[model samples]
Target: MIELLIEQRRRNLGGGMSVGRVLPFAKRRMVGPFIFFDHIGPLDLVAGIDRSVDVRPHPHIGLSTVTYLFSGEIMHRDSLGYAQAIRPQEVNWMTAGSGITHSERLEKARAIGDHLHGIQAWVALPTADEESAPSFTHYEGNDLPSWSDGGVHGQLIAGSAYGLTASARTHSPLFYVHLELEARATAEIPSAFSERAVYVAKGEVEIGGERLVAGQMAVLKQGASSVSATQPSTVMVLGGEPVGERFLYWNFVSSSQDRLRQASADWKAGRMKLPDADDQEFIPLPEGDPAKPS
Candidate 1:
C-alpha cells in the first residue's frame, strides 16, 4: 500500500524559472524533519539574461538547508563569513540554528546552455538543537557513499540509508538516497527507518501497483516496498521518524509558534545581520503568504 501520493505544485518565480513545491501541504505538513522541499529547474538558461538567480539575502531559524544540484552550480554566501561554490552532486548544508542570513546566486560563469536542476530542502532541527550555534558545511560528491547492484545505482545523498551512512552532519536520524535504474530494473527499498517515501525526478516507476511519474512524491506504507522502472529512471528516497511538530512562517521553522512569530517580527524589524559582501540587498517579507523561504 501507498501512504500518500503528492502532486507537485508549481510556483513561478518570474524570470522564466518555476519551482515545484512538494512539501508543507495542507494535508501533510512534513515527512520527518523535512519541512520544505522544492525541485528547481531542469531548464535551459540563457547566457547573460538568465544568468544570475539573484535570490538576495534572507533570514532563517531552527532548520538546516540542504542544496543539492543535479546540473548547474550555485554560489552560497552566509553570515558565517563563508562563500562556497556548490557544483553538481555537492551538498551545501547550512544550519540556521538560532538564526542566520544568507544568499544564493548562479555560479560565476553562468554561461549559456547551463541547465539548472536541483533539489533544495529544509530540515527542521530538533527542539534541543534548534538554538544551537549556526554553521555550514559542503560535502563533495566523491566523499559520499555510492554503490551499484543488480543494475540499480544509488548513493547516500544525506543521512543514512541502504547500509550506508553519509558524512553529512545531521542532528537526527534520517535517510535520503538518490537512485537511478536502467530500463526494466527493480529494486527493493529497505525498511531500515521508521518512515520512508520516494520522489520521482525522472522516468517511470511502479510502486504498489501504481505508476509514479516525474515530480510525484509517494509516501510508502509500513514495511519494505519494491520499485521497478519501466524505463530509465531517477528517484530520491527520503524520510525518518517525525521530529514531533514544527511551526513555519516564511523561512522560519520552530517548535514554538511564538518563536516563529518572533523571528518574523525580527526580520520585519531588520534585526538580522547581513553578510558583508552581500549586505545591502535583503528580501522583504511578502505581503502575501510570507510563507516563502529566504
Candidate 2:
C-alpha cells in the first residue's frame, strides 16, 4: 500500500546545473536511514560547458555520501587525500563520521562532454558512530552483485537485497538496489525491511496499480508490494530500519542540535580542512542561523 507520493523539486547546485532533489521532503523527512537524495542530470552536457558547473569543495558530517553513476564520469577528491574517478555502475562511498570536505569535478566531461546521470544519497550515521573517524571507499562496477530474472535485471548497490549483499561498506541495516525492467517486466519489492520505497528514475512503473513517472517516488506502507514497468524503466529500491530522529542543516546530519551549530561555526572559521587536492575554493556557509533543518 502507498503511504505518500513525493515529487522531485529542482535545486540549483550552483553553476547553472540543477538537480531534482527527492528526499528530505517537508512531509516526509527520512526514508530508512537515507537523509538526503538527489537525482542528477540525464541531460547531455555540451563540450566546453563552464567549469564552474563543477561542484566545489563542500563539507559534510555524521553521514555517508554514496555516489553512483549511470553514465559519464566524476572525479572525486576528499579531505582524506583520496582522488578517484567514478564511472557507470561504480560507487564512491565516503563516510563523514565527524566531518569531511570534498569536491566533485567534471574533469573528463568538461572537455568532450558526456551524458552525466547519477544518484547521490546521504545515509545518516547511527548515533553511536556519529563521531567516529572519517573514511572513504570506492567499489568497482563489476565488484557488486548482479542478478537477472526474466526481464528484470538488478544490481545490489549497497547493503543487502534479494539475498545479494553488496561490497560497499555500510554502517546500518539497509538495502539499495538498481533495477532495469523491460516493458511489461515485473519485480517484487522486498518486504524484509521495516520501511521501503520505490523511485522511478526513468520511464514509468505501476505500483499498487498507480502509475509513477520519472522523478516520482512512492513510499509504501508495511506490506508486500511489487512494481511493473509500464514501459522500459529504471528504478531504485531503498529502505531499512529507521535510525530514529536526526537533525539536518545544510550538509550536516546529527542527533544533537548543538553539534550542528558547532559544525557550522567550524566551517565558517576554517577549522575543518578542505580537500587537499582541490582546496583553492570552497562553498561558504550560508548566511542564516543553523537552527533550520535543510
Candidate 3:
C-alpha cells in the first residue's frame, strides 16, 4: 500500500533550465536516509544557452551527494581536488563529511547541444560521521551490479539489494537501485529494508492497483510489495533505515542546529576552502535568519 504520493515540483535553476524537485517535501522531510532528490532535465540543451545554467561552487556538510546520469554528461569539480566527468549509467559519489565545496558544469553538453537527463540525491550522514573527512569517488557502470529478468533490467547504485552489493561506499544501511521495466512487465520492490519508495523516472507503473506516471513517487507502507509497468518504464527504487532526524539549511545537513550555524558562518567568512579548480567564484549564503532550518 502507498503511504504517501509525492508530486514533483518544477524548480527553475535559472538560465531557462528547470528541475523536478521531489524530496524535502513539507509533509515528508526525509525518506530513509535520503534527504534531498532532484530530477534533472531530459531536456534539449539548445545552442547559446547561458553560462548561468551551470551550477557554481557551493558548500555542504553532514551528507554525501550521489550523482547519476541517464543521458549526457556533467563535469564535477570538488574541494577534494577531483575533477571528473560523469556520463550515463555512471556514479559520482561525494561525501561532505565535515564540509566541502563543489560545482557541476555542463560544458560538454552546452558545446555540442545535447540532451541531458539525470538524478542527484543527498544522503544524510550518520551523526557519528558528520564531521569526518570529506572524500570523492567515481564509479563506472561496470562497477555496479546489473541484472535482467522478467523484462526488467536493474542496476544497484549503492548500498545492497537483490543479493548484490554496489562498489560505491556507504556509511549506513540503505539501497538505491535503478530499474527499467518493459511494457506490462513487473518488478519486486525489495522489502527487506524498513523504509522503501519507488520513483517513476520515465513512463508509468502500477503498485497495489494504483497508477503512477512519470515524475511521481510512491512512498510505500510496510509490506508494500511490487510494481508493474503500464508501459515501458524507468524507475528508481530507494530507501533504508532512518538515520535519525536531521536539520537542513541551504546545502547543509546536521543533527545540531549549532553545527549548521557554525557552517554558515564559516562559509560566509571564507573559512571553508572552495574547489581548487573552480575557486574563482562561489555561491554566497542566502539572506535569512541564521536560526532558520530551510
User: For model 3, what is the C-alpha lDDT against the true structure?
Assistant: 0.92
Of candidates 2 and 1, the better by TM-score: 2
Better of 1 and 2 by lDDT: 2
How high is the lDDT of residue 46 in model 3?
73
For model 2, the stretches where C-alpha displacement exceeds 4 angstroms are none
- Lowest-scoring 10 consecutive residues by lDDT in candidate 1? 285-294
How many residue-pair clashes does candidate 3 contain? Answer: 0
| Least accurate 10 contiguous residues by lDDT in model 2 | 285-294
lDDT of 1 by residue, 76-185 (tens): 99988999988877889999999999998764536544677889999999989999999999998676799998889987878877777889899998888778999888
Note the Cα lDDT for every prediction shown: 0.84, 0.92, 0.92
lDDT winner, 1 or 3: 3
lDDT of 2 at 79: 91
Model 2 pairs whose backbones collide: none
In the range 1-294, model 2's lDDT, one tens digit per residue, is 889999999999889789999999999999999988899988788788887899999999999999998898999999999999989888999999999999999988788988999899999999999998999999975668999998999999999889888988788899999999999999999899998999988999999899999999999999999999989999999999888899999999999989999999999999999899985788999887777766
**TM-score against truth, every candidate:** 0.94, 0.98, 0.98
Cα RMSD to the true fold for all candidates? 2.3, 0.9, 1.0
Per-candidate clashes, comma-separated? 0, 0, 0
Lowest summed lDDT window (length 10), candidate 3: 44-53
Q: Per-residue lDDT for 152-210 in model 3, tens only?
A: 99999999999999999899999999999999999999888888889999999999999
